[model samples]
Target: MSLHLRKPSFVLISGLLLSLAFTAISLISYYVANQSLNQHITTNTLPLTSDTIYSEVQRDLLQPVLVSSLMAQDTFVHDWIEEGEQNPEQMQRYLKAIQQRYDAFTAFFVSEYTHKYYHSTGILKQVSDTLPADRWYFHSRKAPEEFNINLDLDTANTSITTLFVNHKVTDEQGKLLGIIGVGLASTTIKELIETYQSRYGRQVYFIDAQGKVTMQGSQFSGASDIHEVKGLQNIAPEILSSPEGSYTYTNDNQTYLIKTRFIPELSWYLIVQHTEQSEARITTTLWINLTISLAVIIIVLLLQHFTLGGYQRRLEYMANTDPLTGASSRHAFEMLFQQILNFAKRQKHPVSTILVDIDHFKTFNDNYGHLLGDTILTNVAKVLTQNLRQADTLCRWGGDEFFIVLPNCHQSNALLIAEKMRQEIEESLQVINDQQLHVTASFGVAEYSNDETTVSLFNRTDLALYRAKSKNRNQVEVATESAFKTV
Candidate 1:
């Protein structure tokens, strides 16, 4: 009776409604599956990844801290500090030994008696209570912790970024002597993070309790503050307060899963974040069945990916290379310097550095305007490139100061090279607006010492450069070991 009463239009309308219901069910099922997969990843996979990171940090970063503590308790360090720290050469040699034995970036010591900061390079600076730069030493003196990890400029490697493991040095009576520790380059930490991120496809970063990013993987750049990261500000407060946990955050209509773990050793938070946007994309694709439209979307995505990849490569190149001189940038040169130093240490070969400063550069800039100054810089760089060996590295350190590194070269050879470079620069001419510009530069050369660090070598070389400038401009001076010993 019911079938007879139903009209054709009613039956058609009922069939449409049933189809719609099935479609809705399928969509809902897809959504559920996606959510389940993401939850599984956050709960199971992220914890494992976080554990791996923790283990690596323990092995690499914490080991240094432990070693530093052991050094603090060692009789040799205590005896050395107690002996008045009179022989800086001995102190320098001991610091160098510590650095070499542990394969640390650098080693340092501070003497409460002399109020002088000592490192592999000899006396770095005099610590004063009033100076802001010396405050770290004073603060460490009062801190209760046995050791602490912090970021500071690595003066040895041209003030490049470094992570310092500062440990308090004390005497047998438990009185504070000074401080001693090692440095790890920030580049190394970044590389470690980048490797893990690439292997596991997770965003990994280390942030301090104050929400400042101390270390991070290569995926993030430019900014290090946690609040600055996209989609992180909303959940940052909770993540900081909790020692270990997971949370979800949504930004720009996309969801992200975050896992946090506190590292007591570093007093920093280890954060791992995973985005669900990929899963969302998959869900969207499931609902769209237009073959041509799908193909078009894929093509556009491919184009965008390639374009972004190329752009990233270009940016990296620009960052590493000097824009005006086409020489290595300071940061890039520091990385290369470290590699060369390592190689030299292993091979027992000598490495030499030369610092070149353009003479009367300020006067020239004042007379000729910045455009001509830039032209002169470019011309000088060309002359330097022509004179240097292909294996050598030339860097525009800063403001009319150029640095060159020569591997497997001694002081005598480096001095000769510097002399030639000086002469070439003096003769090199830049013509602008029908006028010839003449430039002269001063050169300072220093060879790497077996027990000296890059910073010490740089300081010695800089002193030689100063001597050259003081005696007369456009001259080459080789740093004498006596100069370093005196410092």
Candidate 2:
């Protein structure tokens, strides 16, 4: 009886297997390619691009700063200011020569003794502390840095936005004479940023340390503050904290690769942002290919009826388990958690989760190599599995992280279980490179609340985990009941 259907079943099963294989191949190929592209951008392309932009900015903007510094140090300018700035014609001629020689947009000097402003056009205005327009000179006097960049109105150019490199002028006695600086129209900096953005196809902008957008390419002209920019405000804290580096920022469900370099000459941060939309396009293309492959496979399978009991079981196991640690994958964990959540909702039983993170996992990888990291991860998974109930679900939640779902458990019980697991992991040792390596982990436990979505519950647990890591690692933290009550 079985032999009669064997041939037909074999043909159908083969077709189904081939379909799954092709779909998996397409997905894996897309994943690898996307990862390679992102890695290339993060490691090679972004740094090179940022360095190139930094060099270009220095080449263009450094001249004004140098000119301002030179003018500040000039003996003639110092003597003129010391002479009470009485010779207006001489001052005007001197300013004109400096501005024309350097091809600067404008040149200016403020006398500390006379409290007067002298420009290329001569005695443009008085240095009044009470006037907002004249406040730049007062502020420049109090500034600690010898050379500073500021955005101010260019009176010579009808008060258009200008980049001023203000340099402090002091006499031989080290007394402050006044401020000497050269101005360049802000449009010049904007054009430079626009040119770079167009050439590199990256969003370019200049941000001061306070996160104020001083000058930006036309693409980002809508917002003058980094905190107001969409997809950027979310990661503004990280950006302002880091002096120079690369970071990945996620907003509106899209991720952006942000590279930042500091421009000391301008006292501003140069930011180059590129989106991962290319990866999304690649995934979309692969899905289209997979859909075609699936259609072909379905047609072939329908023509031949299929069955592969053992092979199907193997495939199911592979799909559900993490290849490296033999623990449940994120997908499998989500499915199981959903089932547990449904049952708990009906039975009025509680479901809890513990998010675990290995402490200093990156250090382990750096010191012992990635091979040892993999070994340690596998061993840690084993330790977690041995400590959990058979009904509990243990999942590999990406690198150096694991999630354990406990059904029919309350917050207190979940915390106890997490603490036990944390201790077990701390005690567990791995012999790598002939050295005994003891590992520790941080745990965050949270019980699901009534009417709470899975995402909200997970976020609460993640917050607890973050707190645990922040306070101290190798410990367990429980989410506050009030925190989930609102969720």
Query: CA lDDT of each candidate?
Result: 0.77, 0.80
lDDT by residue (1-487, candidate 1, tens digit) is 3423443345446445544543554445464777665665577556756876776676678657866886787665776666666568877987898899878888888777777888898788888999876777787888898777777776566568877888988765788887888888778878878977876566888889999988876567525786776667777788889999988877668787888999886788888888775766746644552232234334434544455456556667878999779999999888888889889998999999999999888887788655567778888898889988889999999889999999989889998889988887777564545666667899999988777777887899999999999987889988999977865
Q: Which candidate tops lDDT?
A: 2
Candidate 1 accuracy as TM-score: 0.50
Residue 197 in model 2: shift from native, Å?
Answer: 0.9
lDDT for each residue of candidate 2 in 330-439, tens digit (9 for 90 to 100): 98788888889989999999899999999899999888655578888988888889888888999999899999999898889888888888887787654555777778
